[model samples]
Target: MKTAGRQTDAIVLGAGIVGVSIALHLQERGRRVLLVDRGEPGAETSHGNAGLIERASVVPYAFPRGLSTLAAFASNRSIAVRYRPATLLRMAPWLARYWWNSAPGRLDRLGQAILPLIERCLDEHRQWTKAAGTESLMRDEGWIELYRSRRGLQQAVKAAAELAAYRLAYDVLDEAALQAREPGLLAGIVAGAVHWRDPATVSDPGAVTRAYAALFTARGGELRHADAAGLQQDSTGWRLSAGGEDWRAPEAVVALGPWSNDLCEPLGYRFPLGFKRGYHMHYAAAADTAPRHPLCDVEAGFVLTPMARGIRLTTGIELAARDAPSDSWQLDQAERQPLAVPEGFSLRWLHRDGAAPGSASLLTDALATLDWPAGEGSLYLWAACEHAAFRQIRAAARQYLRPEIDA
Candidate 1:
């Protein structure tokens, strides 16, 4: 362990994609940023996603309205969603708020509000990929949402009209067209698919985050291992303990994502943050039989994405406490149909207050405001900075120096 008196213009806690992006953007704006995380950047939720930049996600996911859908979820018979009764009980309030926000009118307003941000996701990622020289890790070919039944296809076609209204590009591929595009798909497994052509996919989402962190450090920003619990505010500003040293900054941004509440709740700032835990596992593909694009089994609740590691099968959502013990039943259920024999497995949990898009947009707007009053306490910059755009600038000064350490 080492100790030293260090100071920075802004300290960013949590080095996930959002945190790293915030740190990078602040650095570009000439702020000496210190990015702190308990583990390596992107090693958490950022690394485990389906890897789509989600340009077509103009609309956020709404709570199920149909009786059948609700029944299926309640009975745990739906592959699309699963919940533990105890977890649901604990999350009732947050879930109620989420349900209210998912009303047709509110959902529509949320979609329109998030559309501009969705449109720029690809371009923003492109800039980072180009600068970090991680272009090879990215592909612009988009993704597919495969339907197993005619009803599913019809519902998707109807949704396509709404997507077109937002000027989002997509194509409804019939069974034959789907086969033509992805011959490696299990024969007769899907009726058709909606090809979302605007989003970009990454081979390794975590690696991209690490690359951005590398670029941040290369440009003189600081990346350190720190406990966000130590965050404090006083007449001067913010102070945190990391690597046995006291780090002080006049301004600080908390980008801890799922664990953000740990620090913010202590500081008297509480948002109705919730969690939707998920899981993922990789499998080997037979020779020349890997998927060409990411494929979501719309009704089945799992996605098979062609990743650098292998075919990654990711689960939908599991409502549980953040620290709840892992359950592999979703993975077991998904594997029963033989998507692929799992060679490796991992579990992940996603934390969202309401809808991802809406939550992220609100969070980003809060973070971009720099003149937050110190008397109010340390700023808890939750998930808002994840997709927020920043003026790119490279910093030149290094008053504090530390060797690059990997976690």
Candidate 2:
């Protein structure tokens, strides 16, 4: 084990999914790395996210027809990308560009880039979990995108087309087919469904992160508890300042998720990274009435992943400023969004105080807990439309550092 006093070859700023994954991958290549965070691992945006490995989130949320689609979701509050008036105003330019970039061909390219990354990440997750003796936390039972209206279902035909062209396995189901599979849809609520069999779900994201930290330590990587405040250039490398401690490393990687903006601004790496606050409350399902697999409300911006003891209803995408408490209304919307249930079924919210109104549970007590990150935490690796953008940066950085490291 490396003591914190020891200098290392690489220093990772931020303990979020991206940072930790990078550290673990570097360790695999026999590099000595140090991961620093303000608190523990898996404690920030990573702690509270929709736990789906979105092999199908190929289309960016703000694509063509996105504004109108968002308007449609405004009334229901159950769909995938709800728009807050204020945040939308601030994000207008980005939204416009995002929509313009959603040309069919553009969407195809985006999906192609992201799907492979997700596939790779999921595979890596499987290996990491298995090595840490925690493979059971991930579920391979497939994901369902349920449509309540024919037009809505039709809107997703493009997504279906993409899925098929990409050779991803899925099944389009009518109301009958959906009900037969899950027996939870309210009568007439679902017009059709698209089931993607390959995507995986994490039962407990925090537990998984803990397991990964253990694995990383066992691989001879170092973990340090310190608030990553800033970075400065050194003669031969980078100087990282955190928790009043200074350390130098030949290379440094910033995988700080939402906080990337704060940590990178002083270094002239001005990136427009924003936070989309998401909410999920666990609901204790009636033992006899629990849904068997995870379900995505196609129109709803969230997903419901059922666990052995309860169901976790995670939804909403409030574009709040980072570090702000989640908007109560949005979380309520997720809780209140109706789930089609089987006859004679009953469900109740688990963490009522933590929820706004009608929220759903994320998982049973046996699964895990959503403990808040105190001061700092670990990373929860996720992929988004920005994967290509970040990869380009990584590639460029590698080229620049090859001479230094190899020399």
Candidate 3:
């Protein structure tokens, strides 16, 4: 209890999948790591995903290039994206950069860079899943993207064709074929589906993260419960004092997801990260009644994936303050499915999104002031991501870690 991991080489301040994975990777590099968290690892942001390892996402999900989609977003009624007016206004500039970088040319460049990571995500995931013995948590068959309108299906087909260079395996399912794959879906609502065979899904994302943390600990890494708020930096490196103990490490990694700002701002490393909120609700599931594969309501920008809890209906981006109260309207709109009425364990969740390229200077100046050794900034930021907006953050994030991770 006295100065946990006092002699540790590094202290990772979050226990999400990214932090756990970072701990493991650092251990692989022969660093003795101390992974600290305020609550159970993965019980926060990482627990609430659609649980799809989108191996086939060769192209990133950029901003809608079409005016109709833009207009729909403006209306704030779209199931895929809803925003509180004030919060959206505050986030406009960041959103503008997101829109700007999402231009076809820029997005294509970004996609090409991250293709390797996306390509190898599942195989890498399988390696850990095998090590953690959580292979049962994953489904190798891909997820199905359901298009409500024939026009939507056509657009998707065109998009898929554009990614032919990526050689992703997918089947365009007609109505009958779609029904053949997922008979539970009420017919006539879904016009078609793109069954992407390359990606895989996990039944319990949180459990998978915990499993990874277990693997990290099994390798002689340490896990502790302490508020990252105790973290401080000085001439000696980094120090995190919690309760009666004062822990020290030569370096620390801040992967606290949405809460990264709270700690960073105190340390003079504030960046404009959009703490986009989302929601997920679980419904009871029966074996033969649920869809065989995860079903993404593409038009609605939601996913109804079968999980250990049941069918999890996850909503898309909600551009709000990191601490804003939950708005159930978005989740309510996602309930159009004819499946049995969902009940219980409905809660709003948060994930960090929206990275401002403009904030790079602020980050630079902060580092210039602090002047840590080498390689703190890259490994310290986000792997807590999703969305096309997040991909940009990640692509930029990769820039930070490449030198350190590769070396």
Candidate 4:
């Protein structure tokens, strides 16, 4: 391989779904793009999601605002979300900011701001799914949100009604209706469900992501596997090396998902990004044994989706470091849940060692596109991510390597 090269039009770090999609979009625009990652595309965070392009999720995920809910989580015994005691102190400010921004008016505004993106998520995925010829892996029927209590179901129905202006199609299902729709759901513990009819799902999200990456390559975009730690910027552009060959690009986007902060911190773009980790394991079951659509147990805070491997269950957030060693406590509880199935490695087993790459949940929905060399970022983004953390990260950033940030 050549030891050096002329600059490409763009370099996208992290080959997960987000990175791959960005690279494909850039390539579609006729830019010479290099998609880089240390491992195969979609083999990380992209692989472990609940396999839904949730079009019904018009409202963004907000911090829990209820006193009981907040108190319940504070004890850290909740199955849905657990946090490391050590992370609490360090994350207090971010948490406070999150709570503040979750206020009724603020959250509503944020929801409206991201309405366009949420509305178009399926259309965007369809474009790639079509281009990648992975249509066989997709299911257009969407998923179900289950509630164990009438109160829970009613709340969800009320929320769905509020979102009527968004024009999302969903049905409030009583026990009879839910059982009728998902005969195999083992709904004895469920009082009702919300059948969201818009969001499409996939059997294997990782495979779909890899297919998109493959499409990117087939369309003549360069893909490289290399450590992004070696990334450096100079007058020419941003540079990285792979196979002993130095690669340069006039522009680059860090779409590393949860791992984005790891590389961006070095580049002096560190914000107090939340590393919310979770776990997933496949259960032994066939399509007949599983529901027709992915089912989310709202009370339990997990999603059960039918996959090629079996029924894949994903747990909720565990607030911990990105590189924290895997914990068996959550997995143990997860297995004991209603959806647990008995199985083994070949065809009838469960893998106890599975963990998901944490999502870098940032307060700033995104940093406005940074300029090259000057590399100044904007904290002016409103609605979606307007909060105290913006000012906090901005103040903290100025004390670092002088990244010429714009206030």
After TM-score superposition, the amount by which residue 53's alpha carbon in candidate 4 deviates from its true location, in angstroms, is: 0.4
Kindly give the stretch of ten consecutive residues in candidate 4 with the minimal lDDT sum. 379-388
Which candidate achieves the best TM-score against the true structure? 4
Tell me the whole-model lDDT of each prediction, alpha carbons only: 0.69, 0.58, 0.69, 0.68
How badly does each model clash, as a count of residue pairs?
3, 31, 0, 4
Runs in model 2 with CA error above 4 Å?
1-5, 58-62, 73-79, 241-245, 342-347, 352-407
lDDT of 4 by residue, 134-233 (tens): 9989899878999988899989899889877777888888888988888775646888989989878889888987998899999998998999788887
lDDT computed for candidate 4? 0.68
TM-score of each: 0.85, 0.80, 0.85, 0.86
Looking at candidate 2, what is the lDDT of residue 13?
76
Give residue 276's error in model 1 in angstroms.
0.8
Q: Model 1, residue 214: displacement in angstroms?
A: 0.5
Task: Provide the RMSD of all predictions against the true structure, rounded to 1 decimal.
Answer: 7.6, 8.3, 6.2, 6.4
lDDT by residue for model 1 (20-119), tens: 8878877876889889999998886777667777777666667778898888888985556777898889878877877877888877776665555566
| Model 3 per-residue lDDT tens digits across residues 17-48 | 76787777778778898999999988877777
What lDDT score goes with residue 47 in model 1?
A: 70
Q: Which candidate, 1 or 4, would have the higher TM-score against the true structure?
A: 4
